[model samples]
Target: MADFDKPSSTEEEYFAREDIEKKRKLALQQADQLAAKQREDLRQLHFMKCPKCGMDLHTLKKGHVELDTCFNCKGVWLDAGELEQVLAQGSENNGKVMGAILNLFKRS
Candidate 1:
């Protein structure tokens, strides 16, 4: 014979639900925190300064394309589609591409 008993106490069931809810909330909060940290890291990487002229690199929009430029030397640095990369998935590879392009122009 099986004892067809409801939970021994409603309090225990209530506490169980509360514990589950708490864990769910904590997980959501942790995920939000992680996302925010990643965004901050990307922002730091995307916004750079020109070493030669001491001017902060500025992002500008020309028609539909985005460009990065230095205020002093009028040097334009392109991140090889950086705006799309960052906006899509927070990638930092754009900086490397920009550096390579600039170096190529410098060598010639």
Candidate 2:
């Protein structure tokens, strides 16, 4: 007769596979955490910094929009949808200027 208290070979194999699977899951979770940390670190390093000159950007108010200006390079940057807002508030001369600029990018 076999001893009932002893685990069979199949039971031991099952537990070993379960332990391996648990370790794999933990590794995946740690990788995700590490990736999120890296993205946040990069954002902190580049936030509100100029791309052209690597200088600090200043906010200048124009109508309802806030423009990002780099004093070191004399470069002006517009955020998302700011160009449309500027065109909306601008005069006929400004419209012509924007029209000419837009036309430069149009395909024949």
lDDT tens per residue, model 1, 74-93? 67766777657434432345
lDDT against the true structure, each candidate: 0.67, 0.79
Across 13-98, the per-residue lDDT of candidate 2 in tens digits comes to 99999999999999999999999999999999988889999898888776676778777776668899998877876664666655
Query: How do all models score by TM-score?
Result: 0.42, 0.76
Count backbone overlaps in model 1. 0
Off by over 4 Å in 2: 91-108
C-alpha RMSD between model 2 and the true structure? 7.3
Tell me how candidate 1 scores on lDDT: 0.67
Model 2: how far residue 81 lies from native, Å: 1.3
Measured by TM-score, the strongest candidate is 2
